[model samples]
Target chain A: MASTEQEVLEGLAEIVNEETGIDTAEVELDKSFTDDLDIDSLSMMTIVVNAEERFGVRIPDDEVKNLKTVRDAVTFIQSAQS
Target chain B: MTSSSDTRIVVTGLGATTPIGGTVPETWEALLAGRSGARTLEFDWVAEYSLPVHFAAQIATPPEQVLAKVETRRLDPSSQYALVAAREAWADAGSPDIAPERIAVVVGSGIGGVHTLLNQWDTLREKGPRRVYPLAVPMLMPNGPAAAISLELSARAGAHTPVSACASGAEAMGYAVQLIRSGRADIVVAGGTEAAMHPMPIAGFAAMQALSTRNDDPAAASRPYDTDRDGFVLGEGAAIIVLESEAHAQARGARIYAELAGVGMSADAHHITAPEPEGSGAARAMLEAIETAGAALSDIAHINAHATSTPVGDVAEANAVRRAFGELAGSIPVSATKSMTGHLLGAAGSLEAIFTILSLHHRVAPATINVDNLDPEVGLDVVRGEHRALPEGPIVALNNSFGFGGHNVALAFRSV
Candidate 1:
């Protein structure tokens, strides 16, 4: 019923960068949240919370813990959507 | 393994912004008087949300009144509550002139910034992503409260956040005690904050039948251990205490309220939401705490229970009390302040710990209000109606906290 990967990525991109004053770009998707993008654990939680609200699905804490990459998050969101 | 003699922690300061009162003295005074902070919902949004539970223990005053407008605007309500409590605690500890490297913070919360998360989601959906606030992420993080407090004190030791549901606050306190004992930090600002009186949380708990639906009488809704008890009322706010090593407190001439004797943590590993039927894990936690405190069971005069008024939770905790203290548990007075203050979730344990320390300081146990009829299954001596005088001289009190995911924590305090 929902566009999974694209929507999730787009939603995640909308999460504001506190230091940069811009959206997380597509090129930065593969970069580590902490090292390259400056996305910390709090930012990750915000992304998760936004995703949950958008998809109307409860992301299990264990699964959230496993989501390390943008691709991983996309896959999880796809599976959760189905 | 560290020896018991190696770690001696004392409560150097106390702070709180509870439903009963805004500051430590105010909250303690109202608690000792057995005042109920529960009241009927007066917000017009309640009608819009159509929430089943009509009452909650909201902070008597909003933090905005106490904090700068710019500061309050950027921080989440949970973080705001934590900062308010932390500032009071820091000052209460005589603003100890310790090096920043020697200080630490371990404030926790079960559901941090639910209100912020939900509100921001609405903004994103309705007003577009461009309109979403930049501070949303920082405000909604579960660790935001702890981080904010750590920043306030410039604590370089470490800032830790434990998310063990309702047991989070007590776990934070427990972690702080360990830090002092392990010489990791000479002083730690520890406690919890929660501002989850949001519609979604209320609705979710109501869907699980975890909240009382007594819309008619909001004041009597959270009736723990009573035969007529239904479920808990939701509450919000924060509580924090400044914990320091005995040597540190003595050197600084800090006024010690009580000694944090010991802490024990256990998990049921059985249910995600429901507590174990036999309360075996809970009993083990209490026993382990007493052992860690290096105190006898007979030395415990009071127990601040994690009785949230849920039909199953109250009975299981009572059984756990009986199991841990055995025959003596019946004689020891238990106070279920949730009856008066409602269930604070993450903040419950920390606030209740403060209550336990105050009980020692004042030599009086606060009454459990709205309990018209005691449940037969809960046979413990639950102090009700009027404040009960605690036994004089050096005494110990236990604060029990059981959370979702079967997390159980017990903290013991001895009169200084």
Candidate 2:
């Protein structure tokens, strides 16, 4: 599992790139998952579930709402893992 | 777009990704060569699930062969097949110079994305609901194929999908003819596709005794109008045609294959799965199509019958032909296409439609293979053993398709 926020963001970018057709380089920390990445709510859920599996963490549905950006998802994954 | 009656609509292009071959020319050649597309499926789930009637006619060329990896990953197999055939038809039409606003798409399917729906459900159960693919709904949608083609060409007129069991493809063509006849679109990409080679559908159809259980010799399973015929063999593929108004085709110097003169549609309103035993509704559909085309019964030279190889269905369709055209129907050589291509379900009609158009264009009728003994109940002429050439003159052909819900469609085509 990725320990640091940078490492978590990198992993998230890769997963997002695979799940969605977005370019890996474009999945920056500040990029909004919906607006910037253009991922719908279902795909956003997919990204969260895939991230949880990748990081070995549990992302509850309620917390999923706060994961609006790449940074938010990365931070949440880091916190959940710790 | 006002009504387009009194004007002619012609089929300028044909495309198909079927069990026999991937393209129209290849499929026609295979059909004429008396080839059978059926073979035992190699999926692991077959043995694991113990699916009855293990054979099927899978597509000869998969969509992954033509489309990009990412493209295949995003779309369901049904849409993938549609896109492959639609692209071929579009290109074959010389990429007709028409406004996007004046274009349309209508692709039908008996069942859509069954594989995706089932696989996603499996994932949901095993890996939890969150593990399922996000685009499952769109991918599983029956209209996905038509929508994908509509988007590919930016067809602004409309994107329609008619889900009428096996008759869906013919119904889609019927709807396309109406769209053009109604002046809603100058050009319409129309056809049908199916990719439900999954274990569930096979098991279900087997449970209903709708599929042949001749696992020993798969090729001879679909012996439509033949005495040895047991039942239909499941097949999957897509077929599309580029239909344009005669005025539009002539204006662009498009090579017209046949005139889509008319379409007749009706329903048995009887059974849910089994066809109307008498085929009275099917007969009406054929008669109405000929009447709608304003062509005399004597004018029909060829017929692509919906002989799905089922024992009951074959006799009913034969009776329908006789009832529809009287004694003249006996002389009309009928091409029982399912004998080779198997039963394409939703895609059967368009594939047969393409075959009919090519038959009229080439003035040759492809033989139905594996008919060692013709059933006496089938009164119509079932072309077998060898391909036969047609008379040298303007010719008209009819294609019949009947579905589970007793839905029936008859389309009339004439050579240019």
Candidate 3:
């Protein structure tokens, strides 16, 4: 089943919040995980792995590099789940 | 190069999260009160694995109660304990005004992150390689505690981890003394931390008959110097101390606990696990510590013995003391604190060092509990029943720690 974009964004935000302790409200789609969320590479990897499990999608190693922004991750998870 | 001995090193602060207590004061109080920290394993895995030894001197307080959620999640238990102890020690030192580059951190561990390593391995086996945590490597490394503390303090002089089994903590402190005296750093946060409470280590020690199987009476399991003692009771915790050059400590007006007068280390090269029967190496280390401090054997007032309660180990340490001090060994009060603290392994030396410093500062030596019947082979004047008061005036105390693979360290601390 394909989830809507808003649902994917909220779910990814929750994952980011858990991993980086960033407030979920601030995990806007436009924000970069590294710059805006202040997530380091290790935390970013953790968030990615958790997002894959949550969204029921396989976020390949190559795809991790392209996920620079919250929107990028949400979009990728949405498409991969579909 | 300036000779290291020319610059004296002093202990500015002490911290510990041990089985007996969560902080230095609490631990010291418990030590003086003769409280035992050993208890049966409460984890469900104890039954799940049926480990032969079912008790340990677990930490008095859990790290989660002290550290932030994110911090606990990121750091392994070993690192968590180290951070907790280091924070307290740093605060106790009044947060020295030294530059970042002028301070260092050295923490040792007998086994580094066994909990993390085994948990990650289980994760890998169950959840696949991709599921392994990204921070697993850093969390499981032996240097993790030192690195974490260095990062916390922004200490840049150096972050070193000396792995010497049980002597790791003492070795780290000894290294810190050298670092400060050699002008590498003026202040160093040094100690040891261990969190190998999992069933694997328990079972391994059980297989070797290295752990006390007194599951029914955990409190009396660690009976150092007693004739009935079978082996040591495994323990997990961290003890840290902030060491600064005397000049720097005086300049900052830090409360000096005691001076780290001298450190002696030697290797047996005789056996893998069993100590040299005659304790030649151990005696040499003890004598060297006194000589390095430029003090006579009679100057030694108290000894925090490395008596882990193991039958052979206790006797060996007793022999070492007699060999080192000769006639004077019987006069000096010996306190086998492990009888209460349950053998902290890597952290044992530093925790006992802290106990020794507190003893010197308070002018009393804590009693060695659980010695109902002292071994006939052990001839030292082991303090038991009640804590003993020290005579007034300048005095020196020794904290001895020996590790498997024949590592021996004797640290001498003098009353300030």
User: What RMSD, rounded to one decimal, does every model reach?
Assistant: 10.1, 2.2, 1.4
lDDT for each residue of candidate 3 in B91-170, tens digit (9 for 90 to 100): 99999877899999999999998898999999999999989999999999999999999999999999999999999999
Candidate 3 to truth, TM: 0.98
lDDT (Cα, tens digit) per residue for candidate 2, span B229-325:
8899999999999988888888889999999987899999998877788789999999999988889999999999999998899999998898888
TM-score of 1: 0.83
User: What is model 1's interface RMSD?
Assistant: 7.7
In model 1 chain B, where is the ten-residue run with the lowest total lDDT?
A: B1-10
Query: C-alpha displacement of B268 in model 2, angstroms?
Result: 1.6
Clashes of 1: 0
- When 1 and 3 are scored with TM-score, the better candidate is 3
Where does candidate 1 clash, by residue pair? none
True contacts kept of each: 0.00, 0.56, 0.62
Candidate 3 global CA lDDT score: 0.91
- Candidate 2 CAPRI level: medium
Q: Which of the two, 1 or 3, has more DockQ?
A: 3
Q: Each model: TM-score of chain B?
A: 0.98, 0.98, 0.99
Q: Which candidate ranks first by DockQ, i.e. highest?
A: 3
- Judged by TM-score relative to the true structure, which candidate is superior, 1 or 2? 2
